[model samples]
Target: MQPLPRHWATVRETVAFPNTQEYALTIHGASDLSLEDAQRDAQERMALLIASGGPGQLHDSGLEYYPLRRLPEELLEELRSPGGELIAAISRNRYGSAVLNTDALLISDVDLVEPSPQDRAKPAGGLLSRLFGGGRQAELTPEQQDPDAFGLPGLHRRGEHHERTLHLIEDFRARHPELGVRSYRTRNGFRLLVTGTGAGPSSKRARELMGQLRSDELYMILCRVHDSYRARLTPKPWRIEVDRFEDLGTRTSADETHHAWVARYRAASEDVAVCRLLDVSGPAPSAVEQQIIDLHDRAVRPESGLRLA
Candidate 1:
């Protein structure tokens, strides 16, 4: 599994082309980049982009198995084990939600609905497809091909979706009796934390288990790219009736306006929960798993009686 970098830096520069068009570029580094190192890297990438005559900006492509190496999020907190090993990092996401990033634990986010045909039509490129290529569409089983195969009564009914999702979890538990599974009910689907089955998010075993559980494809790809699993720990801004933060990128500093927005967001989200504890099945979580579970429960307030957002 890839470890989270302790240092982060961003370099910005303006490049003037032969056409007299100047473009502003921003590059990020996470491997304890010094000022000189960042500038050199930025210049090298800028030259490549110029030679290729591509877009002036660097596109994340929503791909990369080691995105955290250049992750552009504001780090909020770090969760370390008693042995002083970093277990997780909480950061403010681009959408203003607090996200938990971890490499040690295997976390899966499974969506209830299947992707539309349009979504499947797009070519699977980037780091994810490069590493875990082929069978993009061929991997779908018969059950996965049918939208109503989950015993969902209606396509738009939330209650039916929730029930079907729970049934899926129960069936999975019955099939794999040796693995420990902690399931949570999310707004769109389910979040699962599994133990006694896999060790790290980057392992083949983790991918196989996620595939067996029908986890979200993009999420699975992200896990592979980041070499870690991520879960949202806070309610979405839209769900709480708050506008998204204006600046949504690698932040050098937080301003008064950002602080005020966070205050309002927290106040509005005070009564909402990100997920609710659905069930725990199969086996007991190990000591390490328990620590992660405790941290997740505390942040998400699974027993708060609040509606999931």
Candidate 2:
């Protein structure tokens, strides 16, 4: 009987982003293996990773597996993107050392065994799901929420269930210092944005945080004003009205100033017909913003001087 196929496996997995987790699994047998044996070896290796919780703390929910017979373009792009967010999955073959990166993992260059004539091995289904893992852990459930209800030094402890969130924010800030995160005041409350220089781990973490907040309804209400000037500005003759919340005076006391600004915006949104507040709170537009607006205006309303060049 021929010996089982040889498989090479990675023992080190690293995640360069805040919202990611990494796992490494070992594969056995590489002494004398065939093509089919090699495939089975890779499958078992991925199964170990899957059992460990996929790529990161978050399981790979959208990963798929394919035979190592051919490399697809999409898989190649995911593996090659310089600053891509996708996880780098690595695997190795036992024969000619054909490095393969299925949709969800990358196998670094390694030898792969060639199949001998009449030597046949069956294809294993569910390689992707097995390697990527399955299901999110229940450790983060509400019942298991952090015991420290009050976040930070002086924040209230009553019903404030965001200990994990606060930790994530602090970790992100510490990790990415160059970027500027502005928490602007509005009728609703605060709007936090992660912006700054290079593309690094912090930015990736910030994006993930933003995604989580956006999904929460509490954060949504604190982000918008009802009677904003943008909503009230009735473009005369055009029948278009803009009622954007006007940001008020700047103060040294961040908390007080934010609260005051929320009130002001709320009042403005409520009295759209009577209040004559101007739009002064728009975010300081960057060069990217200007270019985008210019392009959009030119495409939609060429008559307006909103378009440049």
Candidate 3:
């Protein structure tokens, strides 16, 4: 018997928190402006967003227009802990900002790789002057510095916490062959995907897998993808769903859906083949019977288009 594909409900909701933790809501671009002004803008915007809820609740607004130089040390400490949340530090200095999440949800353990001397030298002269004064220069140890200190741009140091989390996922996949994995790069880090079929033991088995993620040190997280498909027979009346690997949620149907016999080329000489799976249907379809047929068909001609040529 073949397992039926489950329909996952699409959520347009956000994760809820019981309390505001010690995390720093980082806001970028405010480096040019005064910290007080930046904080005021962030607070006002956050209040408004919270009041008018929708997609706003789903996204992290904690870091909007945050002031960096005047950031409090206590907040910095929270940013380093596993439970600490760093809102709105732009990853890769991209156009906008994002939350810097820790694997343990503790922010203090987060460590940024130091920038190169050229990058470090770019800091305002006043900060440089402070580094030279007050005998506080000793606190600026190499190990304690950010990755930008090493002159490597856009390099993030995955503290022990995050590394352990990733390994746990890889380890789980190794133990389970039927499972599929997908990954996507995010502003602060990467997003992981874990998917499989069946119920009973299969669904129950996810708990153990989830435990590994919770206990691991890595800050990355897992999210399930949802999809919908309309039935050709019923048209408006019937629909079905299947879970598939997706890199990011930003793809349009044209970009995500594959066409048979399409050749995608990176360069004039480089060649790559693109193929999409086609649904097989007649007057009636059986999930159990067709699954076997699909398996056999795939085995016989895995590279062929869904339709007969």
Candidate 4:
């Protein structure tokens, strides 16, 4: 996924949280922005996004904006611990940079690496700042308690939470076109980082809903994502569905129908080479069965027999 481009500081340093109970969001632009500015900006936007129904009460947003392939395995291991939320992906300034816990994580300079990970441990609820009193969340040491948390930038680890991560990324792009949009699923739930500005609801209405967002309402905004892109991507009736699939079997006419070779980049969890039909129809009775047989034969792997291609 093309990450939300960093503009905060030209240079960023990602510290391995090292089993810390909490973590920082991102440091992509940290060099340009002061720790205070980064800290304040991330916190305030996160609060608004939460009020608008973004992920609420997260400790750190994790390394939300940068690309992750650049990081190491040990650092990736740490992100597996539940600690951050999608708030880290939100761009606070036109710079398209964000770091929710700059206070907690970026208090001083440290090492850096690529952002992104694949572990999900469910972010705990409530504001660390609120608990610590007046945004002093950074003062709390890792030894305090809580699971040592870590996370992937931009990428969702898995589960319904992925919906939140993707939604935030889309939200930032939709909210601020100047930042440019990143890859994301379509409005109908299909994974497609559609082009153009988002769809429906003036920015005002969209902002209103976002302000009132809560865990329950997270889906509400995510749903809007599809609407935002539905028009931009290729138009198709089926794409509206998130993971819909059909058995691509049964007899059908060859007319109007089309055939094409297909393969899934996904793992073999699904029947590898299974003939999943896209659509079916026939002009005449004989055509239906022949069309199905031909497609089915081509789709499924052939038995131990060879024939002319």
Model 3 residue 160 CA deviation (Å) reads 4.5
Candidate 1 stretches with Cα past 4 Å from truth are 1-27, 33-71, 113-158, 246-250
State the lDDT of candidate 4 residue by residue for 1-309, as single tens digits: 112323222222233333332323332222123545544544454444333322222324542222211111000010111233211121221111111111011001111112234323323232222334443333533322211112223211222233344445445445544322223222122221111222232244443433432212433333342122111111121222212122233112132211210112122212222211222222221322233233223433233122101
Question: lDDT of all the models against the reference?
Answer: 0.68, 0.28, 0.27, 0.25
| lDDT comparing candidate 2 with the true structure | 0.28
Question: Can you give the TM-score per candidate against the true fold?
Answer: 0.71, 0.20, 0.21, 0.17
Return the candidate ranking by lDDT, descending: 1, 2, 3, 4
- For model 3, what is the alpha-carbon lDDT of residue 265? 12
Pick the TM-score winner.
Answer: 1
Residue-level lDDT tens digits of model 2 in 259-292: 5544543343332221111112223434432332
Show where candidate 2 strays beyond 4 Å.
Answer: 1-159, 162-168, 185-189, 197-309
Q: Which candidate would rank higher by lDDT, 2 or 4?
A: 2
Cα error, residue 62 of model 4, in Å, equals 20
TM-score of 3: 0.21
Q: What are the clash counts of all predictions, listed in order?
A: 4, 27, 41, 23
Give the per-residue Cα lDDT of candidate 3 at 276.
Answer: 22
Best by lDDT: 1
Q: Is candidate 2 or candidate 3 better by TM-score?
A: 3
